[model samples]
Target: MSEPWIPIVMRRDGDRLIMEWSDGFKGAVTWKALRDACPCAGCKEEREKPADPFRILKPNELVPLAPNAMPRVGRYAYKIVWSDGHDSGIFTLAHLRELCKPLE
Candidate 1:
């Protein structure tokens, strides 16, 4: 049998990315790293901070993205339209799986 497809919802809360999966799992992803690795041209150009370095910092420095501008794309591999006019961060199933991993 094929694996069940789980729907994942992504939103911006302040400066962090909030994710809710169909399995009742949820987590918040910060913007600094995501912004640095945005993959979008705008984010790429504006990305001045280092991705790995920020991970060592405290959570207070990180802000969550506001939900007001959260993007909800049509049925498309759990894609999300970023608030900064970036609708390209298509969070694929594999990507989500990686993000859901437990931290060391």
Candidate 2:
């Protein structure tokens, strides 16, 4: 299979992470979801709980990240900077590709 297009540009403003793919598609990933799915060990462990998979994050919780503090992950991913100052959640190029996939 062909490699998915990489994000040529990444930007974070407030509570959103915006990416521009090489194919010219743009995506806006929310900080709340990203934070809830942060790939860090702590977040991963928290997600493993059966009783409350997302208890660390309340259903209505929303974290707005600051813009201009996003980190690049080896040119293929980005570490989002959340409004809560959380600089985790490594968003990979492949992950973004999946998000843009059309649902059947």
Candidate 3:
């Protein structure tokens, strides 16, 4: 069987990405989560090699953040250009849908 739905619309709400699939599922994902869950190789590598999962960063190293103006990745996926200057991640529809899970 084929997939029953696809994302028909999407928009940014402050730090969140509001998405609605064709099957009527509605959900929102925060920009922070999207940036952290980046599907690119470098981000994946950094996640896997975290020295301390509980470590907190020093304030000076933190960058002010916001999604940049361009956020499209062809017809199959989307990308986010974060204010911190990281834009390598590509958020595919399948992945975004996965992030839109019901609260347990």
Candidate 4:
């Protein structure tokens, strides 16, 4: 099989995460978008569930969305440590590439 595409450069700039792929593609995604698109099983379940329009959010739920840190996982993914205390998502490079908008 051919080698996977690698993210050679990754950095957080203001509200977006910027990345440059081994294939020369450059992209960026907002922190909120990244967090909302988290691929963890728990997150997937939450997203798949129907929204309750009448439910009131707790104060903690109002916390601003942001990435506190992004730690690499083995050889394929990164775990995003979010400001709201969620850190379960392991976003692979391929997933991240798809999530990002191509930089012109």
Q: Output the number of the TM-score-best candidate.
A: 4
Question: Which regions of candidate 2 fall more than 4 Å away from where they truly are?
Answer: 1-3, 51-68, 83-85, 100-104
The deviation in Å at residue 33 for candidate 3 is 1.2
Report the lDDT tens digits of candidate 2 across residue range 1-104.
88769877766545566768788887776655666667887778868867765557643344333434567788678776655555757878787666543322
The reply for model 1, stretches above 4 Å from the true place, is 39-89, 100-104
The lDDT for every candidate, in the order shown, is 0.52, 0.66, 0.76, 0.90
Q: In each prediction, how many residue pairs overlap at the backbone (N, C-alpha, C within less than 3 A)?
A: 11, 3, 0, 0
Rank candidates, TM-score, best first: 4, 3, 2, 1
Instruction: Estimate the TM-score for candidate 3.
Output: 0.77
The residue-by-residue lDDT of candidate 1 on 1-104, one tens digit each, is 75544546665566566667676667666655454445556565556546675456546335443223433344434544544445656555545544552322
lDDT per residue (tens digit) for residues 1-104 in model 3: 77646777777778787888898888888777777788999989988994886889867338546788546687767887777678888888788888874422
The stretch of ten residues in a row with the least summed lDDT in candidate 3 is 58-67
Winning candidate number (lDDT): 4
| lDDT at 10, model 3 | 78
lDDT of 4 by residue, 1-104 (tens): 88789999998888899999999999999998998899999999999999989989988678768888899998989999988888999999889989989988
RMSD of model 4 against the true structure: 1.2
Which residue pairs of candidate 3 clash?
A: none
Task: Give the TM-score (vs. native) of candidate 4.
Answer: 0.92
Model 4 scores worst on lDDT over the 10 consecutive residues at: 60-69
Q: Sort by lDDT, best first: what order?
A: 4, 3, 2, 1
Q: TM-score of model 1 relative to the true fold?
A: 0.43
